[model samples]
Target: MAWEIGAVRWKVALALAAVLVAGCHGAAAPHAPASASEWHGNGAMGAADWSKQLDVTITIRDYGYLPRELRLRAGQPYRLTLVNYGSVPHYFVAPEFLASVATRKVEVREQAEIKAPVFTSFELRPRGGSLDVYLVPLRPGTYRAYCHVKDHLAMGVEGRIVVE
Candidate 1:
C-alpha cells in the first residue's frame, strides 16, 4: 500500500515538472491584424501611385499637435506622418475628417501596414513611435482632428484639416 502511494506521488511530481518545463518555453500568441472595412471612398480618386504622393509630418507632444492647421487640396494624395513625443499613448481620431478622405494605407514604424479602409483612429504607443498615414481628401471642408485619449482633446491636442 505504501509503495502504491509513493508511485502515485512520483507520477504527480513528474507531471507537474513537465507542465512547468512546457510553460517555460511556451510561445506567445501572434498579434492579429486590424480588420479591414468595406467602405472604400466616397467618390474620391482611387489610390495614388507611390511616386507622386506628398509627405507631411506632424509631431505629437504632451498636449498639442504641431502646426495646428493643415491646408490640403482635394484629390491630391498626401502622406501624413505622426510622431509621438509624449510619455503616454495617444490616439488620433478624426471621424468627419476620415470620412471625407480616401485612405491609401497606414504604416506603423517597424510594425504593420494597414491598407485602405483603415481604422478611423490609430494609437501611438508612448514616446517616439511613428505612424504614416497615406490619404487623399475627397471633399472640400474644414474638419476637426483631435486626440481622443482621456482629456487630451481638452488639453489642446487638436488640429484642423482644411481641404480645398
Candidate 2:
C-alpha cells in the first residue's frame, strides 16, 4: 500500500510538470498577423495595394488588430501606426482617457471602470493605407480602440491595449 501511494504521487507530480511546461511554451495561432504583414496594393488608381503598417508596431486588419492587445506605461507617449490591411478603408479612434487607461494596465489586469477616454485618434485610406497618432497611458486599465466607420467595428475591426 505504501509503494502504491508513492507511485501515485509521482505520477501526479509528473502530470503537473508537463502541464506547466505546455502552459509556459504555448504557441500563438499560425494565421495570426506578424509584427508586420507583407501586403501589396492593387490600385484601382488607389493606394489600396500599398496597405502597410505606419508608426505603431501594431495594426488593424479586416476584422481584428494584430497584437489585438498592447501594453504600456503611464505618462509616456506612443506613436501608434495603422494600415488598411483589409479590403475596405479603416481608421482608429477611441476616447483619449480610455486609451490611457488601456496602456496603463501594463502587466496587471482586473475589472475596469471607464470614467472617460484617453486617445486623440487617426485615420487611414483604402486599398492599403497607413497613419500615425500619438498615445499616452494615464490611469492603468484596459480599453478597446475601435474604428468608428459604419459597421466597421461590428465586423471585428477593433483591438485592446493595456497600459501601466
Candidate 3:
C-alpha cells in the first residue's frame, strides 16, 4: 500500500509538470482577456478599433534596432510593428518580454497570422519584410531584446523593452 501511494504521488507530480511545460511553451490556445467584449469571437479585432491601439514601430536595420529603448505602459493595447530593412534576415528575440505580454495575435505580412499564448522570437525576412504583434503588456519590468543570428548580439544588434 505504501509503494502504491508513492507511485501515485510521483505520477501526479509528473503530470503537473507536463501541464506547466505545455502552458509555458504555448501548446494550448491563448485565453481571452478578462474583458470578453474587447475581443471578437473570430479573434480579429474590428477595423475601427485598430486606430485606438498605440502604434509602436521598431525598425530593424542591418545590425541594430533603431530607438534602442522602447517604453510601454502596462495594461495598454499596442500595435507593435517590426519592419526589417536589412539585406539579410534578422531576428527579434525577447523571450521574457514576449512571455510577459497578453498576445492578441502576430500577423506576418503576406502570410497567415499566428495566435498563440506566447512568442519567443521573430525572424524578419530581408528587405521590407514586416510583422505586426498585437499585445497588451501584462507585467511591468525591463527586458532585453536582441538578435541571435550568428553573433548578431555581439555586433551591437540589441535593444531594451521597458514596461511600466
Q: Which candidate number would show the highest lDDT if scored against the true structure?
A: 3
- 26-80 in candidate 3: lDDT tens per residue? 7443543334433432233333245568999999988799879999987778999
Prediction 3 TM-score vs. true = 0.70
Error of 1 at 104 (Å): 1.2
Candidate 2 vs candidate 3, lDDT winner: 3
Give candidate 3 regions above 4 Å deviation: 1-51
Q: By descending lDDT, how would the candidates be arranged?
A: 3, 1, 2
Which ten residues in a row are the worst by lDDT in model 3?
39-48
lDDT of 2: 0.55
Candidate 1 lDDT score at position 91: 78
lDDT of 2 by residue, 1-164 (tens): 99999999999999999999887557533322222211111121122221331235666687877887877655455555566777777777756433232221111114332221223455666655664443344457776778888987888888887767
- lDDT by residue for model 1 (111-164), tens: 798865535677887788889988887779998888987899989888888999
